[model samples]
Target: MAKGTKSTWSLRRKLILAAIAVVVVLGLALGLGLGLTIGRNGGSDNGNDNGNAPTPTGSPLPSPTGKLPWTPRVNDTWQIILQNNIELSDDATSVTPNVSVFDVDMFDTPKETIDTLHRLGKRVLCYWSGGSYEPGRPDSDQFQKDDMGKELDGWPGEKWLKLSSDGVRTIMKSRVELSAQKGCDAVDVDNVDGYQNDNGINLTEQDSIDFLSYLSNLTVPLNMSLGLKNAGDIIPSVLPIVHFSVNEQCVAEGECQTFHAFIDAGKPVFHIEYPDNAGSKLKEDIVQNFCGDTGDASGSGGFSTVLKKMDLDGWVEYCDQSVETTALNSTDQGS
Candidate 1:
């Protein structure tokens, strides 16, 4: 889920909005109509691609403008905190389990934090909410009133974005740009499941596909990896562009199998199961429903699972009941 609210933060964006719009529309048109795109789902190439655009056949665009930082491997162990910014007080490379990656907020986390992780030999996955507009963000003013749809369920101060808008995709691309600038190895975009919610904009699954592919233009050429956060339905068409999957509560929702195709294709599904509210932990038996052998098969053997609190923080409990909290000087943001 979001970090502060449900499963979802800040970055002041200052760019030529008008230029971004033109670039995105033209690039999307060309990729859909003419070019030979490079990436593909490599597995389970199912689903008629949104029908609005054909399966991409050319190189991605708005093409990467610069160099990329890193790419995560399949089944790489990782940790994420989207709702808060941290002030780390210890060596980043010394954490237990020697997890290979860390996913944190874009603006909230200082660039030095990302630098530290790099020094530790760990890759950083920058996280941001691409499907919702949050208040008080750096780019808050960039959103036109109609650009925001219904408020996210239980996630106050956030509203589903009009993903189909040229402006929205432009802003989202800037976020990925921000991630690369901050030295993030990959981008973890959330709330893409907007089509499944009662989002006031009437946003459809096609809107997400178009938006996600456009965002990839900036990542692929730079070599930074991309991840789909919890929009399993579009996987068949989008699998090729993304490097991994960051899912929320699939086992609890009995939808783990929906993402197994990623596994079959040799991609990692960074799975999270949160059965408790913040400041609490799930009972051991209940935890097994997500982590044990009998649980969701997509995550059973190859999945990288983490038992976390609803508000993702440093506190973490693995399936084996092994608990650890990465060293931090501070905690949760806007909770």
Candidate 2:
């Protein structure tokens, strides 16, 4: 009777072990099938894309190769000081008003300042002339005389460049490379509206479109963002490639509607309005005129607006009626 019991127990143990092995094999097969399905779909149901998802129609442009560039979102707070480089000590831990991004002159801004801003958790947008020739830039002499066009009306020593010129594009490529080297998160390409201005080179809207594409080619590989500066007419053409819009006086000119497309596209509009008394204390009406949501300021609801001096100095007034001046080194530079 004891021997019979032992035989029965051994058979039962074998049966249980075989059942466990079958369950383990089934789990492995199910996991493998799920992994292959997720791989084919480019992402899992958890909403994380593995860089293989299909590019959606009308989406913000992605880089051709390498990692994607920084994309500034709608209404992201910012401060732009193009007149001079910011003043930040190496050991400092904070900046005034504590904005998310700072736009400074690319050539005037030292690498050390950019590094410090990064340490303080702020991104830097290096400002440079993409469609114009400025006299004192380090690459000023590299611009071919044939590429130089008519002088800008109010900005002295700066002339529009032929957007189609190969020489101009080469110089711009170098500037983009320099921006990458300086730890700049993005580049603000100014004067792209040369097509609207009296550009002597007969720059058409198509020229601006092509030029931005060329710039995108250079900026994308470096993992740097690019911004459109007041070229609202070509927004439809270049919007996919650019990450933001550095609009000047859209509120004052009643053209804020044209730039709202960036906001709609999930990109920021770094709007700047130079009120009459912006250099000093601003009056209530002036603030309302630029920052109010009604009338001229309609469709500008998500703009990152800043009331700055015409000179674009350090003093900045936000839509909240709060004013702050960024500290700057005495060394000044032209835009």
Candidate 3:
């Protein structure tokens, strides 16, 4: 072979080898880049990855007390009138001592009231506003202007809160801590269904689901049962987490069946029907229609019904023709 031809063939062979080496290096680099990207994305569905993805930093499930296994069932007779500082009557004979539960305002119901009920062997559920901002509450000023959305209709000085706000959740956490501190058995977190009303914050059902999940995580840890208050639409999502359902005027609004999910889940639905003359006079028909017919409202079986005034004063009339009214002094009337 000629020297020039041999040299040219050698040079061509070297260029091909160099090109192959470069391609191999580029392929390895691309694979490494993709592996790093997947690791940063935390591409695991098991929720165990802690790379760039956010780690859930809050409380855990099954609670510290192990998810309240207690189910509040119907025929569970109860009395709850959240007026100001009215005490449960010491005279058990005259006051119907068979009452199973008593729900009262967290702040207004003094520790003595809870102690008195406990002495009477009654379960007490402390009430708190978990979604709305009330001007009279102790933590009212803690709510930021941005956290408030709009004033509630017909309710003066009360505003709907942004369900996703950290500030609002902090205040609610304080309220739950207060309920636990008060030795209450359960918590009736009110105004949780702000999405159902004109909340002005564009809150959705998912927002309420997240909020209730957060709330249940808080209360269940303290061995305190939590009640879903009147947010029937999100029942399927929240029923598994909550222990009871406090429904208002389901018969009037024709939404009683929505609450039956709680009952079907072996949980209690504390049904309250506020008739037109609830405060002034007791309407026999309203009481009969609510608890009487099994199919009157929505073909659901029996429900624990109570006749209450709009303001939720101490006056209560059960299906069995029993009436109990609180006797409050001027100071007890916190207004």
Candidate 4:
């Protein structure tokens, strides 16, 4: 994990977590973001997060709830963000970027916007910070001082949450329920990899795995899909429970190989990589490696990869060098 350039200061922030695929976390340190498979009773009781649920005792086995909503498939193209609300195209038969999915801010987006994406044949994944506390989210007041620890470096107003806390688990369960109510096909629970960082909560790898199991229970009953965001080490344990995985910088950090479990298991690894140098255009070699790391032990043949800037706005460039800019509303432009 040698250091990278300045535009990738975000990359450097992640490299600080060396070999842990900490790249997606730079945005976790901020936002750009980004589902579940599940059972009915893995965490707390249904729709009953009083911010006082118990720690997940091993994941309840995956018991199909008769019907499941759209679980993102392997090789599904997608985009992600949390800093702003996504604005879809007005055309009813067509969608901007025309990707199979759009992963965006959960609370910030209106249900009408999600409904619009649905009309255009897209599965929407709502993003929520599941492992950390942000000062501005609608549920900010619910977090107690003892429930959280140190702020995420380089990202203001964000702190690593105590994953083992019964109260914190309840808040996360509430969020999963919200995603279902808002019509999200899946929920992307970010920052669950806090155990891999300097998260002051002293989180452990098992803590993350257990928390993921807990999240799965909440969505499975609703029939909403779910994804594990970049806690690669726990993939083996949670793979049966989650629908897919949302990853950051596995290519750049050379850990793309580790997520083969997701691909081999017939699930998607929604992967992203910021360039070694930001601001500079995507160099030919960089694009070649990210999209074409094919047919090898390290080659990620089935990953749905996207090249994005650290901010994770609508602008996206694919492996083929084609680019699409989704429209951003005035409110999303920091206006």
Candidate 5:
């Protein structure tokens, strides 16, 4: 062959080889891109790339938002008394009213008290302010000024909280963690309905709903039941996320039906009614009037009513004509 002709043939051969390499690289790149898209869409059930598998096209799996296994449910026939410090009887065999549930202050009720109640086959619900800042609470200082909004009307030193604040959520999460650490079966998150009040920050019902959703997300993973404390307006929205409803003065306010949604949904409403005069003084008429004597207490028959004083001391009067006060020793009473 001529020399120039040989050089041109070699150049043509090199060009052909380069073109082939480019085609192979392009094919591999396309395959990898397709595989990644499939994997990103959640690998197929058969563990193979089958184009027949439908692509997830809508709403992106809800953005992994809110808590899971929501609306932690509590068992029925459980007696709950909201008090500062619940004292066990002298025999210590069982608590009074044959109570099966006790809701006491997180700070005041000791671990031993919860253990005692657990020993008696009772479930303990630790009470704390989730949306309010209480002055006397141990973690009171953790609240930032921006997290606080307005003072709760009747609660002297307590104030509403900014539910969306990161600082507030972190503090509230720590409180829930403390409840679980203290062996509480559930937590009573109080004053969540700041939107209903003049909460100073113009908080809306949606804010409360989002806050509860956040809290439910935190509580459920810990296997802890989360109770909604008197946030009636958002009941329809949060009913599916909260386990129970801890209501105060619903019957007295003639709004028992607002909380009955929990009962309708097969969750308990731990109802509390404060007699105008009873400061830990058990009154039979109050119990009968509230808990229903022949269907008279605000007409909703199945309410679990407990007569407590305004201060929520150890005394509790139940519907079954049983009255017992958890006696607090001087130290327990904070004397």
Candidate 6:
């Protein structure tokens, strides 16, 4: 009976041991399964940056800690071609006339072209209309019907936009975001001067000031610069935040003095004068008529002026009589 009791006790101990061993094995399997499941669900709680985050694509644009935005200097030379995309060979080492900055249509220009320009040590100013709606733009439909006003004079299929509309502001913000994404050094926001036109929206100078302030807030954090395009009346209000002024025909309209506030504030005035005789190389007299820094060109002493045709094609002539025609892929839209 004692021997039988000893054998029974040994068998009970084995069974207990086997049960404990099986529990241990099952607990380990459950722990491993939970670990893998958490990992698969992006719930890893390791509390460490394991470098497994999803990588982002596209060019590295400005962040809160990225490099400061490019600031253009007074009297900096520049070229603007809005009619089409500027063509550049991938292997080419230089651009024509080799100016310091090129303001091209943001949508029309390819990222490769902007990259090429950067490789050539040139800054790019992406152009987009902020206060006007144009058909055929990718974001054109995004604007509400009530956000549009009368058609812009001389610009077919383009209409003035209400500067106060939230939808309009949203679209403009996206355009600015696009400029930053494209690695553009600055953005030339055009048609902010709708207050000066017979816009159906009755936009006032105060509206322009508020709109520019809004744009400044977006651009400053993105490390991109903002430019006021032909909104001279509100210069004093917005000049502190605006980095530059893209004044069109200021020399012709006796308004260079007004836009020269940018120059006086240590900012650039990228002045353009559209001459009727700009299709070909301008004569010395015609050059003097616009670049003389007197009469209509008064207060343009420090302006970085360019002579172009009314259509703003690739043909450009500088004050010093130098001319260049940027090669284009020949698309029919402005960015």
Q: What is the C-alpha lDDT of each candidate?
A: 0.73, 0.82, 0.74, 0.76, 0.71, 0.82
RMSD (Å) per prediction: 19.2, 10.0, 11.3, 22.3, 10.8, 15.0
lDDT of 4: 0.76
Residue 262 in candidate 3, Cα distance off native in Å? 1.1
lDDT of 4 by residue, 31-106 (tens): 5322022333333343322222332233354335444444677788887766577665555566568898899899
Residue 57 displacement in candidate 2 (angstroms) = 6.5
Q: Candidate 5 on 44-104: residue-level lDDT in tens?
A: 2322222333321211121232222222233344444444466665348866656567777
Angstrom error at residue 24, model 6 = 69
**Error at 79, model 6, angstroms:** 0.6
lDDT of 3 at 116: 75
Q: How does residue 177 of candidate 1 score in lDDT?
A: 76
The TM-scores, one per candidate, come to 0.76, 0.81, 0.76, 0.77, 0.72, 0.78
Rank the models by lDDT, top first.
2, 6, 4, 3, 1, 5
User: What is candidate 1's local distance difference test score?
Assistant: 0.73
Question: Among these predicted structures, which one has the highest lDDT?
Answer: 2
Compared with the true structure, what per-residue lDDT tens digits does model 1 show for residues 173-213? 78877887888877888898899999988989998988788
| Cα deviation of 121, candidate 6, in Å | 0.5
Say which candidate scores most in TM-score.
2
Model 3 lDDT at residue 195: 90
lDDT of 5: 0.71
Select the stronger candidate by TM-score from 2 and 6. Answer: 2
Off by over 4 Å in 3: 1-60, 63-71, 88-97, 279-283, 294-296, 329-335
| After superposition, candidate 4 runs with Cα above 4 Å error | 1-65, 89-93, 276-281, 294-297, 331-335
Cα lDDT tens digits, model 2, 1-335, are: 99999999999999999999999999999999999985554322212121332211232344454245556666678998988778889999898869988999999999999999999988889999999999989989999889988999998989999988889998999899999999998999998889898888899999999888888878876878788999889998888778789999988788998998887776789999987767666787888888877899987888899998888878888888888888888653221
Distance (Å) between predicted and true CA of 245, model 5? Answer: 0.8
TM for candidate 5 is: 0.72
